[model samples]
Target: MQKTRPILAWETLLDIARTDAPAPLRERVEHALRRAIDDGHLVPGSALPPSRTLAENLGVSRWVITEAYGQLVAEGVLDARAGSVTRVAAPTLSERMPPPHPPSDHPAPTATPVDARFDLRPGLPDLRATPRARWGSAVKAALSSIADRDLAAAHPGGYAPARQAVSDYLGRSRHVATTADRVVITHGASDGMSILARELRRQGHRAILVEDPSWPRLRDIAQTHGLRTIPIPVDDDGIDVEALAAASVRTGARVALLTPAHQFPVGAALSPARREQVIAWAHAVDGLIIEDDYDAEFRYDRRPIAALQRLAPDRVALIGSLSKSVSPALGLGWMVLPHGLNPEHSPAMPSLIDQAALAHFLVRGDLERHLRAARSRFRRRRAALLDALRAELPDASISGIAAGMHLLLELPAGADAAELARRGRDHGLALTPLRRYEDVSRRPEALVLGYGNLDDTLVSAATAALATLLRARSETPVASVRSERTLTG
Candidate 1:
């Protein structure tokens, strides 16, 4: 007896293909299909539509659909036979291993929300302000400028024009004196760090120095590459250079990863003196400094601090990305390496098409124009957020607003930030506690408020709701304890 094929709905498949994803259309479609199968949205026996039908429904070409299906089939995630249905393969076909699960005693924590009215989580940019039209124009121009052969693959280092464009942008904007040969195009700052960590490990480095209360992912990334991390505390003037030097010498940690331009979450620019001291420390230990220059462009006050690489380009690997300046959806970033580090040793480079488009975006001044407009809008949003917080929560202390998309809000003593964040969730408001960023040690209760993606209305509403919650909680809290350490915001 013949069995019937389980038809997959085109709409269902399209739902997973996010429009904001930086991947190309074909890649996005393929990724959605793989995700669907992995998540059981499409079972092993489920059959995808023919290429022509899916293309017609998606408004893409038959070739695109065919390519996506072909790639999946090659990857063993799907199975296709001549004159038959293309069905999701059995789990056995996919050799990919599931990610290692955390121990039962220590569960992994997720910050994503199911259905929230206001999401004030950190590390996201203003998606509404993304320059869609300008980016499309840049991509079109890039396509016109590239030869057919260029579509095959880019050089391991990067596409030449894009590298040159990135180098020029760094020199012009960040005051980093670098040539194209020193620039390595990467997927993003994370990928560049992973590469650097692996290289450090290969070079017999045992440990890396990172900031305490930093993005948890940084430590995870370092550990994933078989390197131990030594968390150095940060203060208002940025990383405690004296402690960093001490930690480096004591632990023999030769690699230090820092966000000196505008420190993540805390938003403290490294003081001029501290910058010099840090460089001298790097020289003293014969170490490497990985500077993450994310979000250095949108400084509302005065000119943004120059890249630390400007001072000691020979000892710093400067990483920056359009993820903050342009849009995170466009996962394009670059690294300017010191003279000694091998530029040809990148783990993976971005696609030629993306690199070319970013090159055009930079060369045509589209990035500069977009930054100017985005800065104006973000400045207004930041002001609105600060105003709302001040008016609604008079007793609440706020800091870390000098730059970046997030700020730190301190509740009165004896208030539980986690409980407050939970109360916020009840009101359909998503929030994160500053405690989440502390990997090695515990800090005082504080909330990290991200204002970049929130409009004035949402920010006001969310902050007001939080204020009410905090007022109720503060009224009943009587227990108090003294804290010995304070993380500078």
Candidate 2:
């Protein structure tokens, strides 16, 4: 038994039609009435007011109302009885329309929160120190100097001046043995690695040696290019070069990817002996090395180590980016390739505006100035973090603090790193479990804590919170139980 819908009165119809008119009054009225019937706004078998009365109520002429009603009648949209009463006709399409979908009881899950208040995310540079004014000036200068030909279609490789600027910068900073022609600009270090992997695959190489417990994304890039990754273990003195050689020989891997200068989260500069041995292995196997010179500029303890590419120019491709030194948002990186090795695979180049701006930035020595100031600032932050960590976790053996923005803290044997990370999150802190970097079970349980971006107050607070959680959960040796009560209270 269906309940009857009330008749749509003339005033109600006029009220519905009073929405902003699309254009002329005639077209507006006609379309509005027809739409109302079609959409069941004026329901089937409902009475419509007489034209004269409807027009009078709507403030439109009677002819307008009559014309609209006559049009609907001709279209079989309305039924006009002999008594001169117009009623809405039964809807043909509306009757066949699908029912509205019911709303779901469960909504989509929200994205994971990235902005942890005490975020200690490793590998993130101090973005707050980016020289914005200098960058803007460089961009302006670059725009003013950009030639008409630069706006025309250029090679997908990259702008020559930008590439040259990068080449000169690398030669001066990393001591990479290369020229402007050999430098290929990329969006960033990751993109540069991907491009190199693709080229290696093109050359029929299937396997490449990677440092175990290295940046996971580096292995991902190689694997994504269809290359099998052979994990070479990394020790306190950087990658074990002998193990690397043995693994490469066994796996028939002709390419090795390494971070020789300030080895990632571990912060080990490859021992001179191991660096020489790895280069020898590359020569022995006719292999090539890809040196990721990421974060070489932020060395705190002593003079920065020279790049491995400097020693083996013909057998190494050095990749570096401004992301770590300047800011990650500046997506600019370069690869200084070995001579005679043509990376013919063209990558989609970055914006000409960005390229030109970076070129000007490099040439103007703004990068050096910023790095000088940033190094001092980072050094202070690094010292603060170390002091706090020492004060909090006396028994913990923290390594990799000699260089880079992060340090690896080795927890007590049998302690749960993953669980500690979970507890850290409970206190609004973010921790990177060391196990995440290794695909194998060689490395011990540890946490890679980055003090790069956080200020002194943030560093102290975050470390203190982490220390409290660790003390509550584990019996790991801490500096003193006295600070624990202070932190918790």
* Top candidate when judged by TM-score against the true structure: 1
Question: How many clashes (backbone N, Cα, C below 3 Å) per candidate?
Answer: 0, 1
TM-scores of all candidate predictions against the true structure: 0.77, 0.76
Check candidate 1 and list the clashing pairs: none
Give, for candidate 1, the lowest lDDT window spanning 10 residues.
Answer: 478-487
Alpha carbon deviation, residue 284, candidate 2 (Å):
0.9
lDDT of 1 by residue, 297-410 (tens): 878877776789988988999888887777777888888889878833664577788899999999999999988887888788888888887687655667773677888887
lDDT of each: 0.80, 0.80
Give the Cα error of residue 218 in candidate 1, in Å.
2.1
User: Native-vs-model 1 lDDT?
Assistant: 0.80
lDDT of 2 by residue, 192-246 (tens): 8888898899899998898888898888999999999998888778898888878
